[model samples]
Target: MFDDRASVATAAGMRLAQAGVRWDVVKVRRFLGLQAIEHIEQPGAVAVDPHSPEPMLYFFVPAGTLADWDVPDTRALNSTECTTHVVLPPGHREAPPGPYWLLPPSCGLTPTDTLHRALERALHRPDPHPHFRIDTAAMRADAAQLIGDAAELPESTVLPQLVQRLRGHLMVLVPHVEDRMRAFARTAETRLVAQVTVGEAQRRLNSVPGLTFISEIKHAQTLARSVEALCRHAEVPTHTVAKAPAPTVGVVQQ
Candidate 1:
């Protein structure tokens, strides 16, 4: 059966204990101040603070058997306040392994590299599912394309419509990209610790499922070229200014 909130919290506490990381209710209070993080109950899914507005973090515990629960892309939490996700590996008989913490941009790790490391450690799986990785790359490429398209749109009646379309595309793609990037960074870190070549590690990433989007590769190259052109334009000085010399400190003779 899927783990409940109390069960997940207990497991999370246990993991933290094993890692020698202390948890204090006081710390939660200190970080959140007077703002109350509300909890809501969702059937077949565990959710905490579901009702709160933007900048609110929600935690979910999967319902039904842990194996049956569809593991969501951990990257989705990157934009949310924070989301605690739990996933079970194959053949597990007991509760799913984690109440892994997911913090948003407001948390310490805002950059892609840092967030990726944290997720890898949290998931702790030897092999990430292939679909997850491929989808992630596709998402990144799609997001980049949408961003480019949005940039190219002329300020006109159709511009708002184009911008909205890009936003919708990003809403779907950004999370997957973030999640897979995290997993990749973590796995790469492990390989690094074992003194493996970075190239080999990347090769392993290439092996992951759904990575067959050759078009995305071409798109990324095009994007890079466009960025280079933009940079060159930016580098070209627009205007020249006259220089002024500093005044001497010594008194001038009359």
Candidate 2:
């Protein structure tokens, strides 16, 4: 955007800037329809987008230096015919240098690192909800009977479908969990009536069967995170720092 037209000097200046490794932005030119700078000389570095058909130009300058780039074509662009959109992506200035090496010792753990550790630990931890053990073969056979074609599908394809079916059945399954909990309470009450120890009742209550597996819980949470991250990555204009998805469940982590 040096205040000069495209010529040997302009090209040389661009080359010099590229070689110098300094940076700025993305410029968009809204012409008859939609057009963007699809590719550029530098891979992830600066780029320029200009309308080939029209007198207008679109440039990918480092975020802050839009004013500088538009200088040459300012008069022409500020006229009635031309329109330029200088889209500044999420701005980022390099962090000021500090004793970063000393961080590992001094900064105990960043919030993100701490969260990751907790989620990882939860994921690895024994499934707190482990209770019923399904007969895999029987379950597969039942599934195969219900969906004739799907049953013929390989395990890789079928297992996920089965799991999805099970998840869909959670509303049905939750009632069973509730019934079991009620039964446990009744038994505990009866035992307590018969003068059993409080510690014994507590142990029995804690031993109640869990509704699902630990691995499943952790995996669901992981999957949720991945989906959220994918959405964020897609939603955000640029790939700069975007907020992370909060942990929601377990295997996905329980």
Candidate 3:
């Protein structure tokens, strides 16, 4: 019988510990795992396999616990079903190209209640599309940065390049958002249907870096056409401000 401190040494300079003998593991995706880490104060022995096809984090919990986990995108690994071995680092430090510790083992394991609540919040309390991993917060930050850049510098200086960068990021986001809106339109009320189309156009236009386009551009239709063209050719070569026309406003200047 293995004691709490006992571990079977392997030839690969790693150790294998039998699950349910000492502790159970809560396996989760890296994103959700990060979320869980954010929710908890001090987590225990969180191991991450960054090289895996889908990187996973393993959270050590009390043995014979959380086997029938109800949390989404998480798996509770215990020895209830079968014998399991947990690959542990040889020492108290991280080794790359293999499992490394995000949070090394402490005197305690992660509380299941805290972990479950964290996963629940991470799942339901974020943006509208909870299922999709659209980092809208990062996108909004980029948009804000673009606004600041446009305000600080002349349009001819470096504003064009800033706009292009923001535009590329927005292009990647637009299609995913459009598809979600369309799906909503089909099931939503008739009055809501037109709102989707209008909102879609407005959002695309509004996402065009500075607020000047919405305020000063007289030829809205032409600008809309340009934005649409960019959306359609998102995968193709990127068009500079000189090539992309900004109607009635010399924002591009070229």
Candidate 4:
């Protein structure tokens, strides 16, 4: 029975592949043995027979593969079991349940919610530092030194627009930093999300050693709000951000 089920699943996967549907195979196996015989009456539980090498196989396939194919709504029969399947294209209804034994073409196994949750968890870790950290002062100093050194070099033919190129390089670095941060954040837990936000204060503080200043404070605020909303939806606590302290200047005494 198990071998037949495995064969059927393999055949189904091959059919999908031949039809130009890309997918990954995940296998689920059941065994019936002496112990299984003792508890064979349990519902939804399969018993494996130790003496018999063969067992039963049951599985599910992700719905995305059928997005392009015409799939009937009715359940289909496999060699050993009836299979319940649904087709869900990107941005369609919520994902269906599964130990989804099959992963369809163009449909990576990672679910959107699962990814979001993982990112959220990663971001909420006690450490706020991004995985990759850059010293802005050091970078700027290096850039200035490089440019100054280049200025002294005899014009080795036409210099590729130095300043413009340097500026572009910095622009590229900004996104790289953000990408690293996001990636680090995603690895936290299966529930975190992160968005970079730039604020006037953040902009002014860009020169600060480890601070990150992106586009606007509003964006970060919006992300925080979104996180809060998600927490509410999940019946989780909303995190609060602490306000910065006011700064004061001291006068020199004669």
Global CA lDDT computed for model 3: 0.55
- lDDT per residue (tens digit) for residues 73-169 in model 2: 1221221223332321111211112101101111121222222233333334342123432233332343343343553433444433344333222
lDDT of the candidates, in the order given: 0.27, 0.27, 0.55, 0.27
lDDT of 1 by residue, 52-163 (tens): 2422222222111122222234323221233233331221111112221222111221222332343344344333222422123333443354355553424345433332
TM-score of 4: 0.18
TM-score of each: 0.21, 0.16, 0.49, 0.18
Provide the lDDT at 112 for model 4: 23
Query: What lDDT score goes with residue 2 in model 1?
Result: 25
Of 2 and 3, the candidate ahead on lDDT is 3
Pairs clashing within candidate 1 = 2-64, 38-49, 39-49, 116-182, 130-209
TM-score, structure 1 vs. true: 0.21
lDDT of 4 by residue, 1-254 (tens): 11111122232122112111222112222211111112222212111111224322222233233333222221212222324322222221111121111112223333323322333343343432234233344334434433334524323232222322222233324343334433332333212332232222223222222123222222333322332322232221224323223333562211
When summed lDDT is taken over every stretch of 10 residues in candidate 4, the lowest stretch is: 93-102
